[model samples]
Target: MTKTKIAATSDVSADKVLKSSANGQSVLVAKVGDQYCAIANKCPHLGLPLAKGKYENGVITCPFHGSKFELCSGKNVEWVESFAGIPLPGAAKKLMAMGKTPTDVASFTVTQEGEDLFIEA
Candidate 1:
């Protein structure tokens, strides 16, 4: 495993997700409550960056397809429920998903020592 320095403690907040990289792998780190969590910046559904996605209560919603993921655990909460900020009906949502199944985003180990945060990639 490679330990990579991603950000300072002050660089992340509960309301924000910081986009960084570890060993050339794009990563998104967020401060949830008192812990720092790291996950792949790319959304599994469409391979889009999650930096601009909406984050709240440890969940990050994809800005493109409205897929919601648990930031800390990388769990897929909801998949392809909407398009471009507009809600989709059941049939439309499934159609828009294009037969893609729910997949969890990759999570990394985040170590915070004092003011520096490192990710294991």
Candidate 2:
């Protein structure tokens, strides 16, 4: 695995979101409390950039199709709720029918060295 530094620790704030470039790809980084999380920038639904999406309470919702993901695990938040009989949209239903997995969204490992943040490719 290759690690690339993307930003400074001070660049990110608590409960704030930011986007950076590493390993020739865009990455979404969020600082929640004292922890930092990094994930692939693109949403799997329509290839919309997750860095451009809205982040709240550890959840990142896709702006295009509203496909939500857990920032920490890079897992689809909708799936967990849907399995409990939560009402999902028609588009999401179709995506599930098409066998779209949460793993479709790429994710990376994050590390902080001093004041700099690094992401693994």
Candidate 3:
């Protein structure tokens, strides 16, 4: 495992996901209270960047397909909730899920030394 220093503690504020890289892998780091969590930046559904998604209470929702994921555990809370918050019709949602399946996002370990945060990639 390669430990890469991504950002300072101050750079990642409470409830804000900071986009960074670890050994050429795109990563998103966030501070949930005193714990730091790192996860893949791309949404597994369609590879949409989770950095552009909405985050709340450790849950990040993909902006494109409305897939929600838990940052700390990299679990998929919901797959394809809606399209840009516009409730997708039943048939439409079913059609959209034709080729996609629910999958967990990749999570990484985070280490902190002084004010710097590092991610293991």
Most accurate candidate by TM-score:
1
In Å, residue 26's CA in model 1 sits off its true spot by 1.5
* Residue 7 displacement (Å), model 3: 1.4
**Candidate structures ordered by TM-score, highest first:** 1, 3, 2
Task: Report every candidate's CA lDDT.
Answer: 0.90, 0.71, 0.87
Q: After superposition, how far is residue 32 of candidate 3 from its true place, in Å?
A: 1.0
Q: What is the TM-score of each candidate against the true structure?
A: 0.95, 0.77, 0.92
In candidate 2, list every pair of residues with a backbone clash: none
Worst 10 residues of 2 by lDDT: 78-87
Per-prediction backbone clash count = 0, 0, 0
What clash pairs does model 1 have?
none
- Candidate 3 clash total? 0
Q: What digit string (tens of lDDT, one per residue) describes model 1 on residues 6-42? A: 9999889898788889888988889888889989999
Off by over 4 Å in 1: none
Give the distance in Å from residue 7's predicted Cα in candidate 1 to where it truly belongs: 0.8
